[model samples]
Target: MSKGKRTVIVTGANCGLGFESTKYLLSDKIDEWHVVLACRDESKGKQAIQQIVEIDQEYASRLTFIELDLADLDSVRNFVTNFNQEKLPPLKALICNAATQAPPNISTTKQGYDIVFGVNHLGHFLLTNLLIPHFAKNDEINSIVNVTSDTHDPKNGTPVPVPTYGPVDKLIIPPQETPKRDSRYATSKLCNILFTYELKNRLDKSDEFKNHFRVNCFNPGFMPETSLARYLDPKLFNMIVEGEGKKYRKPIANSSRYLADLVNPQLDKVSNGVYYDGNEIIPSSDESYEVSKQLELWEGSKNLIKTETDFIL
Candidate 1:
């Protein structure tokens, strides 16, 4: 391991937003970052690293791939163990970028939760809670970003329906699934904002963590060409990309750079609980601000996580 560099973890780092963000973190600034690619597939992860080599061979040394399957709670635990064993630099930031929109026809997590909620929200939820103890809470290191989508709000008027937030049980193994899967995708994204805010609230109350941590939400905005929908049926995914959907798709670079900026030191002024589009702070859906829902989601998520992983966070 190289010395004197801050380390960050980016889940689903082998492709799309995660992949591009990793590239930027490794090459866009001074040689000050070490990114651990937390991806489910080792082969794809390493392949992503080689592509980084194509960018600049030196980048390959700055990024490492670690297997993480958010769909499985046990796999999540193993990821933490593996990460700790590597003894990388102090953990600075964690970008929970791994997400999926599974069709209802497909299965949910092993725990029977909706795949979208399971991986997109619960998985990252547990990962962040587990890694809190490892964060380097210094002047320069400490930010947790949860990537979400604007589709959670009905006003945005995307193809997806607005999320229905309530008890955890209903969301787990959601009725029709999302991506219709669109409904599932939207609700899962809402959970992202809810989780981020709830986490910030919890951290704020902790005397040990309040000032040391910064958690925020980010929406890349209508990004279509990304591989975020890889879990959906290939035919459906291809049609969306090949049809009218292609016209409005935000470039991957735009979203990827926006995500990286959220954690980049250059944007340190961005405060906790703030939502962003690129560098601009913006209001999230009105539903995201409900204190009752945030609390409910937090408590229910903890229960599900504990039941599955035997963890109390």
Candidate 2:
């Protein structure tokens, strides 16, 4: 609630890359960001703020924690409603940084979509679409950063299985078999990239958002210390890393700094639908660039979420 400063919402801001990225953002004195830590748990969100405040107590006044459960569509809607009602600075950007890996067995979100795909993609999809209308509150260019992964491509030589994309209907139904956790996780990441491009494309056609928004895909690379790796079965983990933990690996601080730079309000460079591997802009998977697949994923995801929640367009 800092006056004359812009606001940004960092989802899953309580921990991991999200938490560190928020820190880097707040460290920027030029933009002076008033960040909304969009977290699912109130306690965890407060803990994250306390840690940041310990580093610099001045951050306490600038940080606000808003409850958001991306696993549930209803919660996503409620978040927007609550956010709009509250008297805060104008929201200038949205960083969809929350994500979850696949479980040992089949699981579904509260809205019945596959859990891995649900939280990683669908939840962000609905949240992004719903928030678009509010983004026009600012005249300067805003950002939409969707955190994806390099493992979505087999060409990257990740030890785990490459992503596999099938019909949209089947994509939402979690498979009953085991050992597919790695593949499921990769596809969810792929969905993130595809959604990123399509949404940017749609926003491009409208004068209202012609050059007002920059939507991009970000791959944080492999960070061994995150909870994302800890949840995996040890045997599967060994299989995925191939006994080489350093391959495709990056320290969390380095990756989070790159993420923070993408939306730094002071640096108003225009980058739409661009993919970032750690700190570098690079080519993404062949599967991610297909216009056919991108539209299919966009429409399919829209159809599923629109029924359960209100979308802006």
Candidate 3:
């Protein structure tokens, strides 16, 4: 291992935007920037690694994957523990890109939570929380990026309605699966924003961590042929991307490039608790920054995890 590499962690790196971003980041030939590919599929991840190696053998060592499943809490916990065992230096960037959406059938994670809420929201929430301490070592510039969506804005192009059905107020994942599509997915995306706001507040209030970390949420925008596409009915997926839907879905490679550029510290000033679409941090609704909702999401996550892990805030 090079003694002077800048390390970053990217989740869901096996395919689509995550894969493309990893490939670009690794191939950019930036000095000493090791890209740790956090992925759910070990086989696909290794294949990605092999492809990268074929392109540039020297970059292979700089890229590696840690098996991770965003839907499972125990899996996430084990990932963190194993990562800590490696004792890599403080991470420079932590991108929460691993997620799923709109399963035709309602499903739950091993932890018994709604799959969409569990993977897209809670899993990443808990993962970031666990890794915060590891990145809180007074690094000059540390960032946590939650790959969010424009759906959080109800007034946007697609007015996907997010249902209020979340974990019970006390924060229990009901055994019954919520039966809906757009609403459930939208609500979970909203939770992404809420989680970022809540995390930013928590980090800001910390004595040791205040000013040491930055949290930003972003919408990578719509991309076609992503793992997310697998959930959509095949015919609809085809029609939207290739048929009439071409206008709505952009190329996955383009989306990934835009997202990678946004994460680049070179062009953008660090803004904690901000939301970004491409590069610009747009204004969100009052509800997005609502203190009460932030607290509710935070408390609810804590209840589900049922862990006493300290967040340094």
Candidate 4:
């Protein structure tokens, strides 16, 4: 492992926004960063790396792949364990970009949580907490960027309404299945913001973390081309992408530029807990700022993690 180089981990980096962001990081600032492409499928991970290499072969040495299955808590633990065992450089940023939009059917994780919530929120939540110690060890400024969506707030005029509400209890034990997939997905995105908000507050309160660590969330706006909408009916998805969603939709690379900026260490005066809308710091949903709800979500998350895994944060 190289001691002086900065390290970054981008989860779900095999394709879509994650892949594009990884490419931007590696291509735009190759000399400074060593990126870990965290994916559930090793083959897809390798393929992503190959594509990056084809674009710029010089980056091959700086990139590597690690298996991460966000749907399973055990897989999350194993990824962290393997990461620690490698003794890499102090982590500079962790981009929790892996997320899922469930199909019209009810799906559950290995631990039985709703699939959308499990992979999109709970999995990333646990992964971020597990990596906190490693982040704490870094003397340089670091960040944790949770990739969220505008759909998180129904008031934002998302094409689909987010029916489910939060407070941890309702989020963890989803009221229904199948028909509520879109709502569940929206709720999970909301969870991402909530998690980031609560985490930033906690980090700010800690003397050890206040100076070195920053946590923020990002809304990539709407990228209709990404595989995130694969579960939707193709004809409808394409029509929406090409029509109404077009105005909101940005090219994958354009959306990724915002993500890359958030990870930049030299960027000045980033307020903790702020949400970014395509490089602009903007206010998130009002519910995301509720202090009581943030605390409830934090404690509730810890409880769930303890119940599901041997490690507790």
> What is each predicted model's overall lDDT from 0 to 1?
0.81, 0.85, 0.73, 0.81
Task: Kindly list the per-residue Cα lDDT of model 2 for residues 77-145, writing each as its tens digit.
Answer: 999998898667778889999998876554888978888888998999999999998874466778999
- Pairing residues by index, what is the TM-score of model 4? 0.92
lDDT of 1: 0.81
Would you list the rank order by TM-score, best first? Answer: 2, 4, 1, 3
Q: Which ranges in model 3 have alpha carbons more than 4 Å from their true place? A: 1-4, 104-106, 136-139, 159-180, 242-248, 265-268
Runs of candidate 2 exceeding 4 Å displacement: 1-4, 177-181, 235-242
Cα lDDT tens digits, model 3, 217-275, are 88877776677767667776666666644545656676677666544544346577888
Among all candidates shown, the one with the greatest TM-score: 2
TM-score of the candidate numbered 1? 0.90
Question: How do the predictions measure up, each by TM-score?
Answer: 0.90, 0.93, 0.88, 0.92
Measured on C-alpha atoms, candidate 2 has an lDDT of: 0.85
Off by over 4 Å in 4: 1-4, 104-106, 136-139, 174-177, 307-313
lDDT of 4 by residue, 84-142 (tens): 78666668899999998875565777887778888998899888888887773654578
* Residue 52 local lDDT, model 3: 78
Q: Which residue pairs come into collision in candidate 1?
A: 113-173, 114-173, 178-181, 178-184, 179-182
Clashing pairs in 3: 240-245
Candidate 2 least-lDDT 10 residues: 174-183
- What is candidate 3's TM-score against the reference? 0.88
